[model samples]
Target: GAGVSQSPSNKVTEKGKDVELRCDPISGHTALYWYRQSLGQGLEFLIYFQGNSAPDKSGLPSDRFSAERTGGSVSTLTIQRTQQEDSAVYLCASSFLTASGNEQFFGPGTRLTVL
Candidate 1:
């Protein structure tokens, strides 16, 4: 079985430009998550999607950041008007939603650099 995967492992973009980061989760996994890790910082939760439900987007930093999951499989994080502060490693994870807890499987992040 395939694990979570992210595309464009490294992205270098100019400030004010827009960037789209993609993630593919494991098959049949009911839950997916997006996170960002800035320099010297812990992983920051950006969004979460479960099945066909509306996503939990409370963790998104600003209006410039948005995400979408299609057919409960692939997800895309779009950063509009990129900023220097947005430079970070964007990580994706997937898991089964269980009552007790769900262990997350992570992907090699997409390193974003806004110059």
Candidate 2:
């Protein structure tokens, strides 16, 4: 089976421009997550989606950031009015949620550069 994958492994855009990053999770996985890793920083949780329930977006940095999952499979993270501070490696992970806990499989990440 294929693991999580993100598109445009590298993205370069001018400040104030918008960018869309895509992620495809493993089949039949019920939980998906988005994270960002800035230079010399730990992974930062951006959002989480599980089944048909509303997504947990508390981790989103600001109104400029948003995401959506379609058919419970593919997800897109949209960053509007990109900023230099928004430059980072955006990672996607998926997992099968179980009572005993689960491990998240991560993607290579989409490196975003804002200039």
Candidate 3:
């Protein structure tokens, strides 16, 4: 009955480095999603994975962004060659179903800062 959790809660790194963020989805939720929200910006979808379906990565900002979900539960978002432009709050959400507008519960998020 635990909720989703993200690690570090804050990260700062030099530009052109790589960073990995972790997400722990709620148990029994079949759908998981990743999103990015910069300061004063709206949440933008990055990637999604549902039960036995192809992952959706269309919302990823660029080739530097990628993610994967394993065991239908936990997911990790890895950023290659981090840039200052990539600094943002990386949020993770999960839901019972894959329907659009589903009420997804979000984690506190890992705040990434690329300097």
Candidate 4:
């Protein structure tokens, strides 16, 4: 079966440009997540979606960052106004469910560079 997939493996944009990253989760998985990894930094949880429940946007850095899962399968992360601080590798993951301890398969991620 196909695992998580992301588009535009690498992206370079000027400091105020908007960028949209896409993710396609594994078939039938009910859980989806977005994470960001910056240079010389660790992975940071961004947002998550599970089934029909409301998404958890607690981890979103700011209001400029947002995500949505369509048909419970594919997801997209949009950055309203890109900044140098927003430059990082945005990773997406999915799982069967979101329990206390569930396995999450990750996507390769899209590296966004802000110039």
**Root-mean-square deviation of each candidate, in angstroms?**
1.3, 1.5, 1.5, 1.2
Instruction: Itemize residue pairs with steric clashes in candidate 1.
Output: none
Worst 10 residues of 3 by lDDT: 48-57
TM-score of each: 0.94, 0.93, 0.92, 0.94
Per-residue CA lDDT of model 2 for 1-115, tens digit only, reads 7899999999999999999999999999888889999977778999988964535799899999999988988999999999999999999999887223789999999999999
Which stretches in model 3 have alpha-carbon errors above 4 Å?
52-54
Tens digits of per-residue lDDT for model 3 on 31-108?
988899987668888888895354677998899888877788788889999999898999999899889878999999
Put down candidate 1 lDDT per residue, 1-115, tens digits, no spaces: 8899999899999999999999999998889889999977778888898875545789999999999888988999999999999999999999987233779999999999999
Could you tell me the TM-score of candidate 4?
0.94
User: What's the lDDT for all of these models?
Assistant: 0.90, 0.90, 0.88, 0.90
The C-alpha local distance difference test score for the whole of candidate 4 amounts to 0.90
Who is ahead in TM-score, 1 or 3? 1
Checking candidate 2 for backbone clashes, the offending pairs are none
Q: Stretches of candidate 4 above 4 Å error?
A: none
Task: Kindly report the root-mean-square deviation of model 2 from the true structure over all alpha carbons.
Answer: 1.5
Error of 1 at 102 (Å): 0.9
Error of 3 at 109 (Å): 0.5
How many residue-pair clashes does candidate 2 contain?
Answer: 0
